[model samples]
Target: MRIYQFLHNAFLFAASRMQAAGLEGRKEEQRLWIQVNAYRDFIMATGQVYLFEDYLAGVAPTSRPHVSTALGARPDTTSQRVMALLLKAFDETPEPEQKQSVSLLIHQVNFIADTGQLEACEDYIHNRLDYAPLAIAHFTTREEAEAWLMGPAEPPSPADILIGDEYYTAVYSREDNVRFMSRDYVIEPYIEELAAEGIPPTAPAFETRAEAEECLKSHPASPFDFVSIAGEHYLAVHHKRLNRHTLHPVASTLTQWEEQKRVVEREEARYAAMNTEGEDEES
Candidate 1:
């Protein structure tokens, strides 16, 4: 189920990116765009988008290599991740000023809940009047907020759980600490650099561009070497007579690396199952 969801999300992300790139009108892309969004809407209606994204983040790599052509962009920090959920919920990218408002609102909601003030409300925050921001941030009406808060006693969304020290810091500082350390990061080939590394692509391909860049920066290397393919980063290890790099997503980051691993594992399991079935048929 997890793997299925992950692949579904990849499709979701790809469709959205394609739509954003203005390819939505094409026949195949059009069908995909509509279906992806319809499915996304279903997921959102269930309020499980946050959980899905969180799970995806956990299984995906955290690093972004300087060069790697791949699809998708993972939010690097908890706040960006949380903000992404909110953006989807709102169905619009908040303007810069509006983003600040949303950021502040998230911090405020987290604060109200953490200080035990949320418990003191005794009903809906609408009743408290002082906590109107919480209601406004969540539900459209104070009554709605009141009912949900007073009834299930659960936060309106699972994303609320991701609000923590790291998230709050990003909100307050207006900066995510998770960033590339190498400002001058570049991937120039070895002295005998060819237009392309003739080696068959064997290294694990990082699925997302953001994860590849992170891996490029954080994945430690002796004398720190890598090769670039259409701007994607991959670690280069000297092999045979080739100075070419076999670019793969770094294992340490594990975003696409994990996905690739999962794919291979699933294939192996399927192969084993097929073999077992053959043996049974022989019997």
Candidate 2:
């Protein structure tokens, strides 16, 4: 987790949240204060500090799309002060036990922007920042952010490893039948065909069937090869232009698409209930 990146994204999320929270009618200073403090408190509360950057013009985040600013865009006042003083405040101002328990998160954001080291960014993160007993986490998703706070520190695992091996790019042939959906078709045998046309590997395959269908935006084209080692088959996805990592909708038929939607919704509900139950048990 490149903390600077995470922090920037977190600022945007906080600003958008503040805007969504409807702080606009308040005085400008008051709104900024709330926004800044809301984000600051959020960072500190995580302790583990598991953590988007996108900014519209000077306009409030009321309607801006969440995306990172161009490289080197000067951060607004709230972001600047919040990040600049983040470690200082925690490292010095917080109580003694708090300081030791809540370790500092290191960042490569400055180095990347200053040097334009895109390749080096990954290397630096994996080599230096990641998994440091002292390093704080920077989460991207709401689930992970919440987990960082509610769950114990993440145990080191394989996902933390970055092999940089571009072994496969996702490509899939869709099955006409709506129910027979699949994605992340590995065509390494056809690597010559892809290489002759000069296309890099597609985005990595989705680990879930729901995500694969979403990318296809229709019924998965497939003969339905369900590869489940432990009765766990996943739907994968591949689109030339759109991100393969994201989930898309199934489009083969209305009924099938609705089925997929229902499946995803049910899974979400189940997880929500589980989280609530866990919280209740703890309480």
How close is every model to the real structure, measured as TM-score?
0.20, 0.23
Clashes of 1: 22
Report lDDT per candidate: 0.35, 0.33
Worst 10 residues of 2 by lDDT: 157-166
For residues 48-91, write the lDDT of model 1, one tens digit per residue: 44444443344333221111111113235222333344344234
The residue-by-residue lDDT of candidate 2 on 24-48, one tens digit each, is: 5545534543435343333332231
Clashes of each: 22, 22
Model 2: what TM-score?
0.23
**Cα deviation in Å at residue 224, candidate 2?**
25
Q: In model 1, how large is the Cα lDDT of residue 125?
A: 21
- The local distance difference test score of model 2 is 0.33
